[model samples]
Target: MAATVEYDVMMAPEEPERSEEEREREAETCKEKGNVFYAQKDYNEAYNYYTKAIDWSQKNASYYGNRAATLMMLAKYREALEDAQQSVRLDDTFVKGHHREGKCHLLLGNAMAATRCFQKVVELETKNEQARKELKNAAAVLEYERIAEVDFEKRDFRKVVFCMDRALELAPACHRFKILKAECLALLGRYPDAQSVASDILRMDSTNADALYVRGLCLYYEDCIEKAVQFFVQALKMAPDHQKARLACRNAKALKAKKEEGNQAFKDGNFELAHRLYSEALNIDPNNIKTNAKLYCNRGTVNAKLKNVCKAIEDCTNAVKLDETYIKAYLRRAQCYTDTEQYEEAVRDYEKVYQTESTKEHKQLLKNAQLELKKSKRKDYYKILGVDKNASEDEIKKAYRKRALMHHPDRHSGATTEVQKEEEKKFKEVGEAFTILSDPKKKARYDSGQDLDEDGMNMGDFDANNIFKAFFSGPGGFSFEASGPGNFFFQFG
Candidate 1:
């Protein structure tokens, strides 16, 4: 059997060792087949043929570049980047290799590195339109990055978002810009938009710590505190040294603890303790608008319980300013204004609440506040007469006589025109007061806070001269008039 095998081997024409030229020709053939598959959009077959070409001729830059292109088509960006780097290393003067390298770097989110590669391409072929366009795009991304940093430092989050959008248009594969845009959206109180961006990133790379942190930030601002805390914790687990994540996680935990403590204190009727805890919670993270808004509202509730109506209103106003959608804050402030008899302010707050909520309860509260405001705007007859709501008819008459004589326009004839005008106004008010209070029916309606029409029992029917004449003149047409300085005389016709 050994003899037969030796004879067969000897008889078979000796296969010549392949020359370098022959191997190169075979590699070119494989590359042509890869190109054909690529033109057919059969990326898997193209990748297989290109890989074979690289194996056949490992030193060929075109083989590496072709394989890199196929890997990019497969969405294997890191692998493509490695192959692109190898292509450029084999042939530094290859413009296609450098361009592909830049594209890979850009897709990998290394914009600065991509900019360098694109710059190399431009230097190699100054008139290469594709290379020039790519370089411009990369440079634009860097410019937007710089602008975004400045805007973010200035707290111009809207401008930051604009710049991030521009950067994203230039580098759509860049995760860094997406993260920044998501963060800015969260800062602007667009929690859903921010969450959508962060969630998309998480779908692509579940372990992306920055994406997790941004998602947590959106959830935190949306008042999903427990879910936010879980995301923050997971982000911290992934990246222990992430400063923003660390701080956010710490603040979220502290805020939860403080807020819970305040709620407990409030439930226990310890208003002062509750206020203090809520204040501490607010100080924990001023930038956390969503949490801080609730903290302000909680402190305002405590203030209301303590009968600090003005302070409560102030706190609730701050909460509404921080978050306009905070219906509870608006409702609380309206109540505080109502308690303090600030009907105008109460009406405004209630209107805002009703507009946002549109609930029957809110609508009713708004209507009640509007009614109180209308009543407040009306003339206070008792105040004009300097009499109490409980004053007897005799007492009201005495008060009216005293106030009318003091404010009569004739009595102020020697004063300035401005003083006389004011006195005339007061005199009319006093007469109107007497006209309403002297009649039991009118007084009853006024006391009941009824809206008397202009012609019924209001100032429209008031004539100061007629009221004065009726009060002073007797059956013999007796009159009381202002005479010599500060003196009064009576006469009968």
Candidate 2:
């Protein structure tokens, strides 16, 4: 209603260079020409002449009504209503003006207003059966429309339909009533019926934003979110400030676009890009609970892809909190747990997913979790180092030195590519064992159901030269004696 333009006196009259009588004569001439054009079926030209006549003499009630009739022919009901009301305001005795105003009100779906206008027309022209009949019909529609509005405000959409049915019976061709009925049906989850009504309205006026919005809602309810967004966008194009359409369009377009970008990036092995895009989707509608849950689940996948096991578990946990029934959340969280070696937690998650979806893949994942749990429970560091648990510090050191040298990358400098890769893996394993055995605190932690490779100094701790130094050193270690050899020469003393 606020969007309806106020058509106040639209024209400004020129200065009175001529006499008042002469101006009235000029106005009459314009009005005659407007009548000529109206008879010729040139409503646009007729409207221009009427406008000029009104500009010449603002007090001509007939000029206002004539222009209003022309506006009606052009289907500008709101403007016609304004002009007709203006004509009646200027001359209360104008029966044709009242009749035109009532027709405008009827077309605008203001039943009570149409009733009042027709009532006035009947009072001005007794024995007018047309006015009598229209007034009675408008009154019935007004009553039904009142109840429908009250039901709508109460959120009683079924009763809203009940009232609208009677109103439409009295005024079946009213698009406003039909559109209202469609909206009520959509609220009641009758999407197909709502779309049917909207389609009917569109057949009458394809540019009806309300009809477009109803169609969009039907699509949204049917789970065609992307297609629904197009309808919402079209409605918004016509009525930019339609709040519901704007919000729906924004949510659908943003979510779908970001998800598509993320999927493509994930396919192309651009994990960082995928992560960023999914994050943007979450930001678009943070308060959309179900959608946010899905976004969190997808972002968890991205984190898992990027090797962020802890972050992935956290994201999936957040998703589960939003929607506990989300199977993918449990599945993704379990995978992260398995990757991080928290196999018991992984087993619980896989079981959660398997309970709902017991397919071969789910069963295989559960089996994988069970095997990993066993592996995690009994890792043998001493065995990997080729030493007994009771080995002394010196004995452990000698064993580690031998193992590390055998698997070191430099020790296999001329080896094949596959051999070098295998050596690197062995070197990492040996280094992890050495790190655990070398640190008493870490060794105690490992013995107490917790072991971590992150605690180790790893490959950065020693280069080939350092390994050679360790190799050449005595039990008490070696000191360099520069006087025993040439300048800067290494010596074991």
Best by TM-score: 1
The sequence of per-residue lDDT tens digits that candidate 2 reaches over residues 245-310 is 888787777777887898899889898998998898888755455666887888899898888888
Clashes of 2: 0
lDDT of model 2, residue 235: 99
TM-score of each: 0.80, 0.41
lDDT of 1 by residue, 432-487 (tens): 88988899987777766676663255467668878888887756554876676644
CA lDDT, candidate 2, residue 213 = 93
| Residue 127, candidate 1: C-alpha displacement in angstroms | 4.8
In model 1, which regions exceed 4 Å deviation? 1-27, 55-57, 119-129, 385-440, 453-493
Candidate number with greatest lDDT: 1
